[model samples]
Structures are given as structure tokens and as C-alpha cells.
Target: MTSADLHTALLRPAVLQILRAAGFGHARPVVIDTATDLAARYFLLLASSTAQNAFNTHNTFVPTIQDVRLALTQAGALVPQMSTAEEGLRDAVEIEGVMVPFEDLRGVQGFVTWAQGPVNKEIRRIAGFGDDANVEEIAAGLDEQEDYLTALKKKHSKTGEESRYQGTILGKDTELQTVSIIGGPAASIAEWTQQSLSTAQTATLPDADEPATPATSGISSAPLTPIESE
Candidate 1:
């Protein structure tokens, strides 16, 4: 066949339909041990609509619990619990039929249940992380949490003066310089009081170049240069 013909055949709906049919094709090496076990294992099946609609319209494998065993047998795996239905659907399979007794159903069920727990745990493990989650994001979040916890612990342990005095050393030095410039510690209270009194007396003079209206309004329009000492 030509390459184009082969490609067209592959893309044909019927061919694609058969290709998508159940991976195990209704056969199984499936082992079930108990009667109470209803956990269903899944295999990939055809993506076609007809194969799906058969679940409702066809017999034996009609997607119901009652029909499952019969369907399984017809599909060619032995199910001891199933009885022969004179008519439904039949297919030739190469494997020999072996029916498991109803008494062994409980053991099969237990195995299925045990299998399901691990399957569910694996699914959760795979899905637990988000699609966008990566090692960098996890590490960065951990680092931020560590910093927050460290800050919290420091605050919890520190008390009184330690807590209140937390400040930059350079800022403290600047504040000290400002305080010395504004009011030197060596300036006694009496001396500082006298200096303020003299300044106030000078402020009372009309010629003192104090605010003209004493209302403290309007600019002096005075030059910024220091006055000459006569």
C-alpha cells in the first residue's frame, strides 16, 4: 500500500475504534478474593461512542454489578457466579474457562479491597502537588516561614528593655547628636532658664527685628547672613 493509503487506513473511524477497544479486551488475569469487594479496576477502552452505548443496549456487560460476572464470562474470563444465559452475545476466545466458586468470592473481594487502598493512596500522592509546584517555590516558602517563626520566637523571648530598645545603632547615635546640639547636658537648668529669659527680653524690643506685628505673621524679608558685630 502507498504511504498515503496506509495513513488513511490508520485514520479510519472503524480502525481507530478497534484500536481504542478495552486494553484487556474483556479478558483478565484479574484475581478477586472476596464477595464483599465491589472495587472495580479499570482498563482503557475504545474511545468510540458505539462501544460505550453498548453498555446500555447490549446484554451481559451492561455496566451493572448483576451483569458483570456474566459479561466477564462471555467476554471470556470464567466467573463461577454467572449462570449460562441461553441468548445474549457470544464471542470465541482462545482461553479455557475456569469458574471460581462462590465460596472463594470473599477471598477475591479482600484482595481487591487491599489493592484499592494502595491505588487510591498512589493517586493522592500524584495529585497532592499542584501542576505549578516546583522545588524553588517549596524552598522559598520554607525559608519565609522560618524567618517568620524566628521573629516570633525572638519577640516571645525578649521582654521589657530588650523589646523596647530594639533600634538601629546608627539611628540612636544620630538622636544623641541632635539632643547635644539642642540642649547640652552641661547647660545647667538655671543657666538655660537665664538664657531663655534674656532672649525673651530681646524679643520684646521693637527694633529687635522680631515679627513686626507680634502676631508672628509675615516674613521678615531679612537677609540670611549673620549680622555684623559692631
Candidate 2:
């Protein structure tokens, strides 16, 4: 397709207003033109990516709505919340298993809404990220855990320990373990608080296994040993 097709894909007025709102002055023809070109390329790239995703999923060029949604999520296109946030996207995009009209997809607002809410959940689930978690943070955490295990292993090897259990970090019952899951010291503190509490409680309680003997009368009646001569 020619550059005109890309240019036509942009809503020039919307772009100009967006720029003005962002404190930019004078949405000149040159700037608008450049912006339009980039925006068109972005949409085209999204479409291309979505199409490829569809093909990969079904081994066919024809893409389902689910495929397109997954592609948009992978590209981070579904995270931005639009002000309009209109709802009718699901109905518009999927009319009894047929794809939304290409003309409809050109409307950015509706397209954005199409990939949100329930749709975004599917995207996250398909991409293996939960709604409450970020993929980057999860990966970084995994990397940190791996590094911790590696360092601990090296320390063990240097000291000639074969089993990791010999050097495993201990845990606490009432609080998080002192074992480092972060970028600080990795030494673990032996737990004594819980044991101490248990001991204290037991010491205070009356023994159920044995009963106390009744108090004897105040009379001294006991066997006596003979005194030896000096």
C-alpha cells in the first residue's frame, strides 16, 4: 500500500488535540504528517503481528478475535486505558464468529476497548501472566532466586558439603524467614522464639498426667539416723 493509506489511517484532529493537551504548541503540517506516518506504521505493525500470531495458533492466515487479542497484549497495546472507555467492542468485533469490519478497527477508541477487561484477562492467561502479576517482575524474581541458589551452592561446594540440606536456610513460624530473597545478606538466623514460647507456656500450665499429693499435717514424724561420736 502507498503512504497515503497509512496517512489516512490517522485521525489528524485527534492527534492534534492530544498534542495540544500534552502542552505541545502548534500541531504543524510537518509534525502531523510525521506523527501520522508513525501511527500508521504502528497500526500496521500491530496488524502484521496479530496476523502472524493467528497463523501460528491455527496454521492459517485467517485470525480469530482471540488471536488478535493475544497479539495486542503481547505488544502492550491493551494496557493503556482510553478516556472514552466505551464498551460495545465485544459485540462490534465479533458478530457470530466473523471478524469486525476493517473499517471499524480503524477507530482507535473502539479498538482499544476491544482488548480490555475480560479480553485482557484471556491475553494474560494465554501469555502466562496472572492479572495481579507483571511478567518482567516475575522474571526478575526468578532470576534473583536462581542467583541465590547458585551462590549458596558454590559456598557449599567450597566447604565440601554434598547435600544442600546440610546448608539449607532455616525458617521461622511467626515471621518471614531471615534467609535473603533479595540483594542483601544471605545468612539465616536459627529460630528460637517459637520454641521459647512453647517452653514458657508449658512451664506455666498444670500437669495433667500427674496429680498433687494432699498436704500432710504439721507433725514431724520421720525416721532419724544415729549421731556419730566425734
- The best candidate by TM-score is 2
Q: Which lDDT tens digits does candidate 2 get at residues 1-230?
A: 56575346434544554465455787568988788667766887888988898888899889897677667656666554322234434344557898763232333455545644555564444333456654456556752222223444466565554443353332123435465334523233233555667789999998788897677665645656699999
Q: How far off is residue 149 in model 1, in Å?
A: 35
Off by over 4 Å in 1: 1-62, 70-104, 128-230
> What's the TM for model 2?
0.30
Q: What TM-score against the true fold does each predicted structure earn?
A: 0.19, 0.30
The local distance difference test score of model 2 is 0.57
lDDT string for model 1 (93-204, tens) is 3335854323324433554465344433433233333333443554566422222223444556656434544463211222333222345733566667778888899988
Clashes of 2: 0
Best by lDDT: 2
